[model samples]
Every structure is written in structure tokens, then in C-alpha cells.
Target: MTVLDIDGIDTYYGNSHVLHDVSLTLAEGEVVALLGRNGAGKTTTMRSIMGVTPPRRGEITYRGEDIVGKAPNEINERGINLVPEDRRVFPTLTVHENIVLAHKLAADPRPVEEMYELFPVLDGLRRSNAQNLSGGEQQMLAVARALVQRPSLLLLDEPTEGLAPVIVDDLRTMLQDVVEQDVTVLLSEQNVTFAFDLATRGYVIDTGSIVFEGSIEEIREREDLLEQYLAVSPEEVA
Candidate 1:
């Protein structure tokens, strides 16, 4: 079943036209990656879908209901949660406090004990301020917070951007767990290895437009296509 259907979306920021007739569909419980370099409108696409930047044209249907021009909170209430890049945890709040805060507003919050099982390290640092946590811990907190919402559609924008290899691996495992629970993920990422590792399908974007869409195996086999658009050799990274 289609969890999200974006048709001919045209998004803009002020007078700057970004996405041009972009169309994409995500099925229920599917993990799809949005791969693109900087300035390719990946972030814009996430913002548009979440209604932070409403699309100027086209329709955005989530769970069979039109949500094109809805407010961010309204869309979020409809079972779509976004874990934005930079792991935007509240610096002043304790780890426990942050998690509790998210739970307070969650439609169907998970138990705090369950969250601890997902990220065991968080159990020890529950009272620590978010700013004092390491990058990986912060990322875990971000994911845990979003999961509290029990969202059907999760939008992750570059969750592995600046973390160490081990931490990235931990996150990948966590995401794998979420995917196993039948959560649909729409991830925007520049890290090809990370993207391919977590997602079965990918959409490659360039200069605000989609240039390629296929299985991870297909993209990996097409070295020429990857280099031409993303300017990177997957072999070098592999």
C-alpha cells in the first residue's frame, strides 16, 4: 500500500524555485533512500513533505489523505515524524527529560523502558543534559524521541552525517530494527555507503531534480551513472 504519494510537487523558498515537478511514492513499511549531493534539494524535499515548506503545486497525500498545505504539527499528528539532520535535541534538557517531553505529546508513546532497550547507553545517561552527550548518543536520543510518536512514516534526513564509523553502524542496526517493525522510512542522505546499507531502493537527485531511481544493486552496478551525477565512485568507497 502507498503510505505517501507525492505528485508533481513544486517547492520554493522565498523567490527561489527548488523542486520542479518532483514526484515520488513510498509504500507502507518500505525503506527508501533519497540520495543527492548538497544543493540537490534533498532537504527541501523532506521539508516539503513534512509541510515545513508547503509545495506550491501538486498534491501530497499521506495515508490516503491530502496533506499538501497542512501545518507541520498537523501533519506530524497524522503519523509522520521527522528526525532532521544535526540531531536537534534540546541542549538544556536532560536526556530523560527530552524523551519524556516527546512522549508527553506523542500520539501513542512507547514506554521509556522500551526506549532504553533500543539504546541501552541512554539508560545510563538519562539524567545528563543533552549537550553533554556524545554525537552518537545524541543521534540515538533523536531517533528514540521520534519513535515515541509511534509514527507510521518516518522521515530521516542524513542521520549518519558526522558520526564515527562505529556509531554509524549502531544507528544502522537501530534503523534495521525499526524497519523490521514495519515502519516506513524516507531517508535523505549524501553518504552512499550508509544509504545503500540501510535502504533497498534509492532515488538519486541532482540540481533539484530526480535523475535516477532503482534498487541498490542496480545503482552499485552502474558506476558510470553514480560518478556522472554524484561525482563519486562507489567502488572507491566500497
Candidate 2:
């Protein structure tokens, strides 16, 4: 089953075009990575899907219904949630409070205990102020908050953008666990190694357009193509 379909979407900001003819599909229970550098259409594509900035032209079908012009909250209510790159946990709230807030939006949220189990550290620091947590810890809380909503499709934008290498490894493990729980993920990342390791298939975008897309094995076989388009050499990820 195709959970989400973005076909030939052209998104813009003011007069500036951001995403050009972008297209991709996410199958049920599969993890797909959108790979690109800064200023590439990666974030724009995500924003377009969430209807944060509705696409100017094209089709965005979620579970077989057109959602191109739906409101952001409406899109989210339909079981699609985006954990933006900024890790926007409410600073003044406690870890537990942050998770509780998401429940207001979820029609049928998962148990709080499930969230604690998925992120054990959050359980220990349930009462701690979100502002007091470390960068990686904040990221974890952001993800946990989203998962508590029990979204069928999770959109993660640059999830490991500024984390330490060890933390990135831990996040990779956690997200793999998410996939196992039957939540499909569309992760946007510039970290080639992390994306390649977590996603079975990927789309490489450049300057608001898709340049390449295929299985990880196919990408591996074309190191020259990766380097030429993404400036990502095999050695960097290897």
C-alpha cells in the first residue's frame, strides 16, 4: 500500500521557486530517505507535504486522497506528522509535559508508558525542564513527542543534523525500532552514512529537483554519481 504520494509538486516561497517537479512515494511500513545538501529542496518538500507551505502545482495524495491544499493541522490529523529539524520542544515545559501536549492533537495517542519505554532516558528525566536537556536529549524528546501521537507516517527533517557521532548511532537504532513498530518514515538527511544505513531506498535531490533515486545497493554501485551530484564521496560515508 502506498501511504503517501507526491507527484510533480512545485512549491514556492514568495516569487522564489523552492521545489521543482518533485515526486516520491512511500509504501506502507517502509523507510525512505530524501538526500540533499543545504538549500536543496529537502526541507521544502517536507514543508509542502505538511501543507506548511502548500505546493503551487501538483498532486499530494495521502492514503489515496488529495491533500495538497489541506491545512497543516488537518494533514497532521490525518496521521501524518512532521518532526522538524529544529527540535521544537517547548523550552519551559518538562519532558513529560511536552509529550502530554502532543496528546491533545492525537485522536488516538499511544500510551505514555509506551513513550517512556521507547525513550528510556525520557522516563528518568520526566520532570526535567526541556530547556535543560542536552542537544541529543532534546532531539530524543522531540522524536518521542511525535511518536506519542501514533502517526502512521512520520516525516523527519535533518534528524541527525548536529548530533555527535555516538548519538547519531543511537538515533539510527531508535528509528529502526520505529519502523519495526509499523510506522513508515520519510527521513530527510544530508548525512549520507546515516541515511544510507537506515533507508532501503532513497531520492537524491539537487537545486529543487530530483537528480537520482534507487535502492541503496544501486547507489553503492555508483559512487561516481553520488560524488558528482551530491558531492558525497564513498570514503566519507564508508
- The lDDT per prediction is 0.89, 0.90
Q: In model 1, which regions exceed 4 Å deviation? A: none
Candidate 1: which pairs clash? none
Listed in order, each prediction's TM-score against the native is: 0.96, 0.97
Leading candidate by lDDT: 2
**Model 1 RMSD, rounded to 1 decimal:** 1.2
Clash pairs, model 2 backbone:
none
Report model 2's TM-score to 2 decimal places: 0.97
Q: On residues 23-113, what C-alpha lDDT tens digit does candidate 2 reach at each position?
A: 9999998889998888898999999999999999999999999998899999999999899999999999999999999977689999888
